[model samples]
Target: MKRRHFAEGAVVAALAQAVAVPAHAQTRPGGAGWVTSWAASVHGPYPVGNPSAQPEQRFLFPSPPDGARDQTLRLVLRPSVWGRRARLRFSNAFGTAPLVLDGVHAGLQLGSATLVAGTNRPVSFAGTGSVTIPPGGQAWSDPVELPFAAEPASPLLAGRKLAVSFHVAGTSGPMTWHAKALQTSYGTAPGAGARGAEEGEDAFPFSTASWFFLDALDMEAPAGTPVVLCLGDSITDGTASTMNGDDRWPDVLARRLNAAVPNRVAVVNAGIGGNQVVGPAEYGPGKPFPGGPSALARLERDVISLSGVTTVVWLEGTNDFSRNGNASLEAVRDGMVEGVKRIRAGVPGVRVVGATVTSALGSSSAAHGHQGQDENRKALNTFIRDGGLFDAVVDFDRATLDPGSGGLRPEMIPESTTGGPGDKLHPNRAGYLAMGSSIDPAAVLPVRR
Candidate 1:
């Protein structure tokens, strides 16, 4: 009827190891679990242009599936929730207005691809289901009582399957998603995600650079090191990569961390599509995109507010160099300065890595094209590398800039973007791979004792 998570099999492999250990302060060598891994999960508001078949797009979404449509998409996942606390992430990263939630629920499922009966038990934000996410903001549901939670004594989720589904009702259509999901996400009931409803939920875990908002999904870890959050815009968000390929820069970083290092690090991406450094979306006349959010305004909420975050890789601002997105190098510089300062103030002593806004050679963003925009890009990079506003500088431009045209290489641009939505801007899977490899591996992993 109801189960929290998978308790045996591959997921439970560790249960044996977990048993041999002492209860308190033994401090022995560790293997891999949530604490041993880089992050529990990764996904965000950055929407891919489209993934569903044409029919699905029209028949279901008609337009695009925005947050308001409580289109419940089901995925029969066999992943592990092997920790004490869990998180359910929701996004409004692209909403021009706040994203609202109503009648959200996640529980063990009894069916497979199709549904026979859903618990229909409500999910909540800090215990309440109705959550109103701010424009371009994301929210994570408080971990409800998962019939199947992680067990440290063994491979937490040794062998199991989980079916998680939720409801949303604020913004309708035009939803942002990375890849196609398992279940068909039917549109929300007639009037879900609406603005005014007597039921309202309190705050949950959120971050500007967080891939998706996080909530303490009632779950447990090996009871050691905290999590590390890597916050930024699209590049950090890992768009364009093959679905579930784990190719985003954050994903890449996590793999590297888990493969060898110690310390227990988690890289969470909180990037949004069409995110700007200082303003809302940039649909330069005649171009696509509807709106965007200013990176400066969101840094504190997204980057510093995450749970157990020890570091943040601030990599964003490409959208700011619009026809007029940012006034000048001065504007970009001020934003950077303020954003960094605000984060430092909020987190005190947390290491901030300044990732140079990567170069956008053939960018299709309407804001690009003008020599003025290029000027702003170069100008902002100057500050990122020269201003010394961060503990260390991660140069994304240095890693991916093409030797030929001085923009992203052909390998980097996605087929769809090149298919023409806007060539020159985003990268495809290969490109995301290069972007992922570009980062210095040492900077992110845990320190060896």
Candidate 2:
């Protein structure tokens, strides 16, 4: 496939060449401190919350079985950037009462429910191995040094995975989770007690594709490593991407950046399938949908609060024009404008780039394929492209749409997961690759540290 990062814009060409420069010479944002390498935007407690077009059985956990009481959860995540010292963030953002957790551990993931021997490390909060997170609150574990010899600049650690294990002390009233991980993470049966210290799979027999409790991960990196946050809906969340495949647009962009410049930047996804830019005015433990909160309500937590975020790419708004959303085009545009304003106000120097929504004119899904919705999507895209509200624009519509039909390109219509004709609303792996490759890396990495 053609590469987007190899293009020859003067600014980008200069920045691309600078990727190999010494880390000390670059302008690191956090002053050689910790920055988020991976993150999942938490929606609400599992079982009772929204999952946005995902199959129902995937989330049928802590139920039909013993329940989530006293169980250990070992989540596996791929860090975009590596560090010698690592810390994790756990959320009780939608919980009803105090959520007590203990027996936190981190290590390199070897395989299913297994960690590399002698590499496991304990994670603590406030000098204790356990802590109680109050309702609607979140906690960050104290830094735990990774035992691996790979430093931040080590090529050996590139594409490596981390297994983070923790036990819920008692009955978690409601669990906070990111429903569609697209990656399998291990979990233990209810009443399994604290087994985060165990390296074998004996403690964790149950399997899930979703991540619970824990949210974001941060690691120390060289100063100035650009952290790019991709914010949007299902397309950005890799809806039709391969199961267990990190083929999301952001993932593709990350690999492209890594190939050109090993560790100059890290890309994290903040998209939620079925997410809308506006509407669903009230969201929380109450009134939860498969689509979490509106983009406006979540911008502060999902985009602004992330560490070392230098750029944001937003590709959303289809959900707003859907039958369920019913939001006017004007409302959606206003929301996008407000979101950009808020990001600029909150982050100061961060750049927000608008991404045109891809075509869904012929989608077979219940919520899409209407001409009215198509018109609204086109209107929104026009605003995203012509409206001077953003620092720059990525014309995804032009990249993915068929000019003749005003629908998704035929090659982009097959689902990567089930291997059938896709709904046309969400793009397949090939489509994502095209979309990811379409992004001008120069526009994203303007600084090119």
Best by lDDT: 2
- Cα displacement (Å) at residue 426, model 1: 1.6
Model 1 quality (TM-score): 0.64
Which number leads on TM-score?
Answer: 2
State each model's C-alpha RMSD to the native: 10.6, 3.4
RMSD of 1: 10.6
Residue-wise C-alpha lDDT for candidate 2, range 1-449, written one tens digit per residue = 33343443433463554333222222345556666799998887576443433444433353522225888889999999888788898988877778899999999999999999999999999999899999889999998999693566678888889999999887887778888888888877777799999999987777777788888998877666677889988899888988777898899888877766666578999988788999789998766777888999988788887787778899999999999899999999999888899988877677789999998897899989899999998888888888898888988887788878889888888989768888988889888988888887766764533
Structural similarity to truth (TM-score) of each candidate = 0.64, 0.92
Clashes found in each candidate (C-alpha, N, C closer than 3 A)? 61, 6
Q: Residue 53 in model 1: shift from native, Å?
A: 8.6
lDDT of each: 0.48, 0.81
| Full-model lDDT, candidate 1 | 0.48
Give the range where candidate 1 is weakest over 10 consecutive residues by summed lDDT.
202-211
What is the C-alpha lDDT profile of model 1 across 98-151, one tens digit per residue? 555665555444433333243233566776767887755667666555444433
